[model samples]
Target chain A: MKLRVRHVSRYVFDAPVKRLAQSHRLWPAETQGQSVIQWSVETENAVTGSGFRDGAGDWTQTVTVKGPVSEFTVTAEGLVETSDTSGVLRGHRERVPASAYLTGTRITGLTAELRMAAEAALEGMDAASPLDRAHALARYVSDHVVFAPNRTEPATTAAEALEGGEGVCQDHTHVLIALAHAADIPARYVTGYMLSTEDSQGAEASHAWAELHVHGLGWVGFDAANRCCPNEYYIRLGSGYDASDAAPIRGIVDGATQETLDVSVAVTDSARQSQSQRQQ
Target chain B: MAQADQNFFNEMLNGTDVRAAYENLDRWQANMPSDLRSLKQHEAEQLFRRVGITFAVYGEGGDPERLIPFDMFPRVFTADEWRKLERGIKQRAAALNAFLADVYDGREIIRAGKIPEHIVTRNEAFEKAMVGIRPPMNIWSHIVGIDLVRTGRDQFYVLEDNCRTPSGVSYMLQNREIMMRMFPQLFVENRIAPVDGYASALWRTLASVAPKKCEGEPNIVILTPGQFNSAYYEHSFLADLMGVELVEGQDLFVEGDFCWMKTTEGPQKVDVIYRRIDDAFLDPLCFRPDSMLGIPGLMNVYRSGGVTICSAPGAGVADDKAIYTFVPEMVRFYLGEAPILENVPTYQCAKTDDCKYVLENLEELVVKEVHGSGGYGMLVGPKADKAMIELFRDKIRARPQNYIAQPTLALSTVPTFVEEGIAPRHVDLRPYCLVGEKIELVPGGLTRVALNEGSLVVNSSQGGGVKDTWVLAE
Candidate 1:
């Protein structure tokens, strides 16, 4: 499936700044299952700087804006062709070993409540394979934490979301990661885009999920929010220990300007392009 | 007077007679008048104060900026002794650098079953960000300060390795300056090697490791956490000596994949940063978001080969106490040689047998937290009271993996001037080894002496004093 993704983030500052710098991890990962057709990231009032691929196989580019301007906007648009390999994220170039993901981030640390939930989810299922266990853990997290938007903060841990009994895709991914880790499965948080289909729930361009490293199959993505594995409709951007690390955009402004941010993203299937190319 | 341990080596004395290394100093001290000696002591204190040589001791009641008491008597090492120590320090530093490169890249040490996988994988100090990121020249620890303690005449054991931004080189330099000013004739009689060239050596080492992108003369700067830090004086002093800019996080910015230091003139490209800030506080975007002491995209710039960060991030994993036990194996594995220096016998509480033994011998072994430094969170078994011992026992039982136990060896002593006269006090040496194009070290090191009578702890933060160490020229 060929997917087109557009992400725009606008920041309005109360006061103008002398300098603005941002480091973006917005480029789609180059993987065996996914290929980038064309990708470009642009920003108003900013000039693109140098780019490099990080140890985690994510292309990062620096942008600088020297201005007294009160508003700044970053736009990322890309087209990627993805293939389904049964959710196995193969041929992804990441320097970090699978065992490194066994460690948890502050946002995914296991609390007593999370530990109890993980233990309860795996009770009487010890004999199951690692892959099956990962699926069951994802299902358990989805069931326990109702999908409710804006119910938790960005810094919310898996235990906090589970205790509150409500969170969004990010929280669900965190809870699943905590549970998966408790079951001795190496898991990491993944940020990407999901193309909405007729049979599927309306998918957001910005999506998060958990990927567990299975003993025999490598990393397999499981989206607890959609209750399915990542398929051809999914376009992976980057991965980290948690959502904060995998965030697509991170920056710092020089001046102390009270700012408000708005983000808009759209992930669409390029049906028109496919039909036009076929006719030609 | 407390009896001195017969087993411990006294640097100034051999049984009852003065050692050859201290013979000249001993004669000078005997000839000097007591009034002049006290006057010189007062002059030394005044000089230290005038020069603003003080360390900030946090969590204490009184003035935070207190001078580290300087002993009038200097510690002496013969040329032969210095030669042996130099070789050992170089070997240890090389092995440590190799270990860091291996752990971050191929992890052959772990694969070869030399070290446990969990030890590296589970360690918090092991940074995932550094995995497969080859630093310039593959040198992870550009500056290594190896702590050594002597027990017998020829016995020296490495206590720890300070690979991450080791402080106290300033103290070493300052002590020598004061010693020369107070006693000019003592130096004239003894052929003491000069250590004034260390700053230049350090500058060259940093310049040699500049990223491949640097052209012409690489611009180097010292990245400091600012004035409030305990080692701020050293940072500024070194920068001044090296004729480099002393910059803080706010004084630098990342642009065009390179780091630039904000100057009065304009933005200056920084090719190498001798960062004194910890790894967690070096890049806010990459590590700790709440850290205000780090540049926003410095790590990204470093990853792009836009700049070189000396003593690269994740170097601390090599110096962790739990990993310190494997240095001997690392020496053999990397250098294909035996460790010239010995490692103190350690009991890792993570092991079942070691934990059991540590718990059983709580009063006889010194238990230290694996990640703890500056003599904090350590229980000296012989010195700890019953209540402290019991508390530590519970802590060990709760988290056995966080603690390591070692037998308290009799630390060597140097003759120090107390209120009465010269007396033996425990001392340890920390020689700074520079690693870049090559590994080199100054002849002597910072000799920290426990000021309190019979006290074994010698951390400057814990009220330790420093003595000028003299490495006699052959």
Candidate 2:
């Protein structure tokens, strides 16, 4: 599947801000699961610093807008060709040891409840492989954490989300990551774009998922919200310990003034769009 | 200074015959009357106060600002001993930098099975963000402070290494300044190597590691945590000495690809930042989200090669206590040289055999937290009461990986002017080795002394004092 993605984030300040600086991890990842055909990240009147690939195999750069400015918009426009690798992430270049991801972050820590759930998920599968255990944990999270938007806050932990029984994709990802940790599997939070709903491929598509580092299979994607592993429709961006670290555009405005944000992300299947255009 | 234990070796004496380095010092000590010595001590205190080198004496239960008692008697070292020490310290500093460079990039040592995989990768100080981002000259720790303790005339063991921004270099300079002011004739009589070159060497080191984007003379600034910090005096003093800007987190801002300091003249581009701030508080956008002490986009500038951070962010990984054991191996593997200095035999409590040994011999060993510093959260087995030892034992049993134990060495003592004339006190050395395009080691270093009788710990925060450490010029 060839996916065309456009993500725009606009900021409006009540008063002029002194400056705005943002670190962006907005480029599509280089992996066997997806390959970028074309991509460019831009903001009007902002100087983009030289981009460098990080330890996690993500190319990141800094964008600065010298201020006395009222507003600005950061837009990420890209086209990616993705394939179904049965959720296995191959050809991803990274220097960070798999053990680095074993440590839990503030929002993805394993709790007593998470531990109990993890144990229950693989009760009789004592001899099961790490990949199988990871799958079971994702299934368990899908069953327990109901996908409900606005049910949990940004700072909500996996344990808190699990007990509350209502959360978004982020909560589900965090819960699954916590379970994977309890089962002694390395896992990370993945941020990306997902083209959902086949017939109408163009939809609001900013999404998140979890990747478990199995013993032999390396990193395998597991999306508890979708109740399935990531497929050709998924375009992975970057990964981190949790949601905040993996945020595509982390920005700060220097001023005492209050600011507001407006974001829109649309991902469309290119083949369907071209066919519809030909038919019209 | 403490009353010397019979078992502890006294550096000034060799069976009643004064050591060659102390021959002149012995005459000076014997001639001074008790009243005059106290008067000179009083005068020294006034001198220290006037210079504003006073410390808060953390956990020592004193006034907010109190003097770190200055001993009138100076610690002396011969030219031969200092030469050997300089070589050892320089070798260790080079090896440490090599280890850091390798750990962040190839990690050859771990793959060789010399150091366990988990030890480097699992360390909290080991940062993934630093990987593949090479700083200027491929150096991580520009300034290395290695702590050394002596047990006998020829036996010196490294207690630990401080690869991060280590304090107490100011104390070394101040002690010499005050000593010279009080007793000018003593200095005239003995030829001592000058340590004033340290400031210039440090300045050169900082300049040499300037980012590739820097042209002409690189602009340098010392990034301090601000006035309330314990080492604020040292920061300002270093900046003043080196003739550079002393800046707080808010004093600088990132614009475009560079970091600029807001000066009275206007914005100035900073090529090198000798930051005294910790890694977690250096940049808010990169690490901790709630850190107000960090500039929001400073790390972005650092990462993009717009500026350089001295003793780079993840340099602390090489200085960790657990990592200290493998430094000898690093020296052999990287430098292809044998270790000149010895490491204190340490037992990792995480290993079952070591843990059992440490637990069985809790009375004779000193147990310390792996990440703990500043003389806090440590059990001085010999000095500790029965209750504290039991508490540590239980804590170690609960989490063995958090602790490391070493048998207490009878550290060497130097004669210090006490209420009842000169007495022996345990002392340690911390020499600041500067590495950049060139590695420079000043002859003299900070020598801390334990003020209480029979105490082994010599941390200033624990009521220890300092003395002028003199290395004789040949």
Candidate 3:
């Protein structure tokens, strides 16, 4: 599967910060099943400072901002080629089992309501094969947690939304993890960028989803919020046991007494480029 | 000071061998600050940077490579101080281990009124999930780092205990390596006991706790919370030193009641894991459902004894700041022995009398948030301005259970380097101990120094550096 992804995030500050510095952990190194043919990242209002390999062996890029500017924008575009292992799980799948993956994760202490709800949701899921069960689980979470903007400070969790039935991508991912673990399946969180439709402006947006290890098929990506498997429109940044690990960028800033930020992202797949590239 | 010495420092540029680099220490001593303590500290700083003893400080919006300030000069401890520290640390670790065992199986400590059930229940770290889980070795605080501070020449006090992610051993090893090079004559003459065996000992400890099924050749991995963590470097360093694979939660899974690590080869079975991640972030399925840093089914495998997680999940219950004061009692309760080390007199704000005393002496005590670490939410009343003290008073009044207060002590000082020369700086020691099948203390501990002239805060995040502590040959 070939994926041409453009991710653009714009942070407009309430007040311009003087001397801002940051390290971004966004770029994903090409692995065996995935290849990046072309990729580039550009930032406005920030100068690239240092680049180094971090302790966990991830490549990180540092940026320093000499800013009195009201806004900063980071744009990343890449052409990624991913293998379709719908038939057989290979590559990263070998390390994680695809079958009966949910069995070992215990969800005993979770809210009684959530446990019962998950149990009810997985009534027919166990009978289904691992791949189908994963799909069902994703679908159930998507249905259970409504995708709505949650302006909660920092972020909210799956259980918090279970009572309300609404949350953003993070909630969807968490609920999916809880449900999968309830069934004894191993699930992980993925932070990345998802392509936006034509109506949306800009390049790409930060997105969160869940991945389940399916027996025989390997690790399969599922966007519970979208109620579908990750397609060519998805560009994976990193995978963590949860959402916090795979956060696109995390670091500290100095010389600022306080900081308030507003972020916007957009992901668009252009038909013109697709047709032109197909011709080439 | 020697590194800055014109002739000898230049001479050292000519050679790369460890011995040649330190030969100039005698010549540089004359130009150094009059304070021998400061001179040693300056040398320690240069050595730490050179040898790469670093912690990744993730500034909210800055580059994270700012290494923890390292002091070249060590805080020397006589045999007497060491014996007391060893006894205190061992007692504390053993008691905590026993406490955890009791909490999971017996709950005898709470039931006996030695520690109130309400306090245990109120502690945020106390986990209901861990209620019935007894580990293979009945050990929870497997890798303990007991923080100790010297108030006077011979008066050492227990500052705190870090049973969870107590980092900086890597700094100790690397700092000593650099110090030996910078002062080979002093090091050779003094005959410092090598701390290089810590990794091997840690590995042996982890190996000892491997699940019985995979005893022959257990696959051991060091689990980290990933790169962005402040202690990520330590995790990788320990992994490298122990000759084990460094894994993140996503790199592992649970299946068939077994824990498996994702390896280049395949889904290899993992029998033992020295996880640096906190209990809440170790297994999302077991603790916080929102945590992405933990494997979903890891706790299940642990429950079945399919794998061993050292300093097992939920160990934080014993190390809670509020529980620190009871360590002596815990020692007496579990080991039937008097405490070898004494704790700094701590006042739990949760108590009415202590709260009143703390409120009255808000200007003289050091107040700390029960759950905060690395000096994030600590206030020294005397050092703090009125506004800060008032802020602390308001906070404590609002939530007394979440705070603790202790009288500020003149934390002992060792000479360290400054911009002009050497000066006295407050320092503390945290020695790492490993208990798997047996107890082994790393000869040298991480000696943290407050860089600020008169500051008592010695956390790396608070601008503290570390020194290579040496246990001199007896």
Candidate 4:
């Protein structure tokens, strides 16, 4: 699918936050089930950074601020070319068998849960394509867990939310990630901004979703929050093992000022003409 | 001062350019005592950059290179100075070990009223979970890094005691390797004692405290709180160097008063753990209940003598910045000898008189949190403006017992290579001392350099850099 993305986030503070640095991992990871044919990110008045690695092994950049009242705007226009396939569990697939999730029941770390969940979800999914299983798993998670805002931290796990039955988009994505891993799919957490239909003229708020890697199709995007796949409204910030690893902005400051931050984001449907033309 | 080294200072003052004076062949040679030698300034800088001996400065925002500043010149310690420092470090470590053993077991010092009970009871780091628990070998602090600063000629002072998973040993080892390559000729000529054996010494220290049941070949692992910890590099480096497994908290579990690590092969018994996690995060069952970085009942195994944790839990009792005021006193009381190293004049804010004095002289004294490290909870009175001083005064007044005040000593300086040229920068040393079955101080400790001019703070989180410390045989 070809799509144009517009993401904007503004952070207003009670006091100015100097040395403002941010890292974005939202660019869909290049893998098997998903592929990006052409993508370019443009920034205005803000320094676009790259080539720095944080704790989670993702490339990041430190975006300095003009002042305390700062805004980060990212616009990506791209054609996402995706394909999916499935056959015998070969090579690495053999190691992470479809039965591994059933046998390894106890999932400890963030990555381990994804592995187990993918295996479990993929248990009977031998006949389907990698994207077919991923889509199924994403829908299943949305049906199972109800989305509740401000209920979990960025590091909250899929199992924790599934057991608790409450979480935001972060938890939904993690639960889906776990289920995808159980189905033998490699998935990652993505942080970005969601464009609101009501605010078609602008973006809505910061958002989170998940991407699953199929054997041949590369990495395919799934929004467990909206229970649909990503289209033109999603603006990629960064992706990681979990949400905490890809927070839009995080850094330390001196001079002992109590920090209160307010974030406002906006994304608009840049492909409105194309969709209207198809309707006509 | 009529010292022979004074002439070098005069010659530098006479030079048109201070940068040229440090780099000039004749002046640089003359600055070093005939006995001391090192590489040319440029060569040393190249070696440091190549070795990847760097620290991640916490708040410097963007550039990775801005994290840990590196200098060209290595700090030199004469054989005589090293001997004195080694003895002082060993003595202080021994006294501290004894103090920890007593605090957790007998509370002899408390009984004698040497240290106030309220102070001990009110400490944030003082864990009730550690009470009545005696580790194997009865040693609490198996490893300690005693920070020392030499302000004047051979006058060494104990800055602070780092008994809690003290980092920078990896940097110490890495720095020395770089120093050797940069100043190969100087190293051979000076015959500096190699500190490369620290890993082996550390391994032995941890092994000696291994659980009794697994005597012949005990399984020792280095437990880290995970990669988010600021000291994660040190934890991994030490583990790799010691050839031991580095396990995260989740990788460990307690089964019937025994700790075991979950390895890929199977559940391997962990007899000894060089734990880098803080005491509060060591066990969810015993410490912070919400901490996922800790095993639920790992402390139960340690208390039951089924496992040994190096620099045992609650060893922070002696490391408390308030308690630091009494270290020299503890040394005198326990060892029955005067301290080899002097302590900075410290004032306990909890005391009525000292609090009054600190409140009166808030702008002249450096106030620090009793439990804080990494240059946090510190107010440099001299450098601080009136508002900062007022803010710190209020903090101290609100919680007198949690703070301590000290006279800011002019930390000694060493010639360091900077972008402009070589200039004198304040630096401090932290020598690692191992006390297992025996006490062994690594020949050279990590020399932390304050990169900013006239700055006394040398924490990596701040803009401080590091230099290889050479303990010369001469």
Best by DockQ: 2
After superposing candidate 1, which stretches have Cα over 4 Å from the reference? A198-205, A272-280, B1-4, B56-62, B348-364, B367-404
Model 1 RMSD in angstroms = 3.9
True contacts kept of each: 0.53, 0.64, 0.00, 0.00
Model 3 over residues B206-297: C-alpha lDDT tens digits?
A: 88877766758778899988887767777888889989999987787655546667678888988988888778887654456567787755
- For model 1, name the residue pairs that clash: none
* lDDT (10s digit) by residue, model 1, range B1-474: 345458678887877877899888778877878898899999999999998878742213245478878998999899999999899999999999999999888889888999997788777888888887889999999999999999988889998998888888988899999999988888889999999989999998999999999999999999998887777888999999999999999999887768888888999999999999999998878888778999888888888788999889999999987788899999999999988999998898999999999999999998888889877999999888999999999999999999998999899999888777778999999989999998989888899999998888886667688999999999
Give the native contact fraction of candidate 4.
Answer: 0.00
Comparing 3 with 4 on DockQ, the higher-scoring candidate is 3
DockQ of 2: 0.65
Interface RMSD of each: 1.7, 1.3, 18.0, 21.4
Deviation from native of the Cα of residue A230 in model 1, angstroms:
0.5
Each predicted complex: what DockQ? 0.58, 0.65, 0.02, 0.01
Q: lDDT per residue, candidate 2, A1-280, as tens digits?
A: 8999888888899999988888899998778889999999878999777778888999888888888889999889889999999899999999887888887888988788889999999899889888888889999988998887677988999999999998888898999989988988889999988877643221323689999999998999998988888899889999998998888888887888888887787777998853211100
Rank list by lDDT: 2, 1, 3, 4
Candidate 4 C-alpha lDDT tens digits along A1-280: 2334433333434565443433334354343333456655554555443233322223333333334433344544454433332311111111111111211112214455455555665677779876688777887777767776667765566788877777777778778767765554566666765555532211224677877776675556788767777654454555554555345444332123555444443333344533211100
- Lowest-lDDT window of 10 residues in candidate 1 chain B? B55-64
**Over the stretch A13-90, how does candidate 3's per-residue lDDT look in tens digits?**
666654444446567555555667787888775655334333222345555565565667677777777654431223
Q: Which stretches of candidate 4 lie over 4 Å from their true place?
A: A1-280, B1-53, B57-67, B347-405
Lowest lDDT 10-mer window, candidate 4 chain B?
B1-10
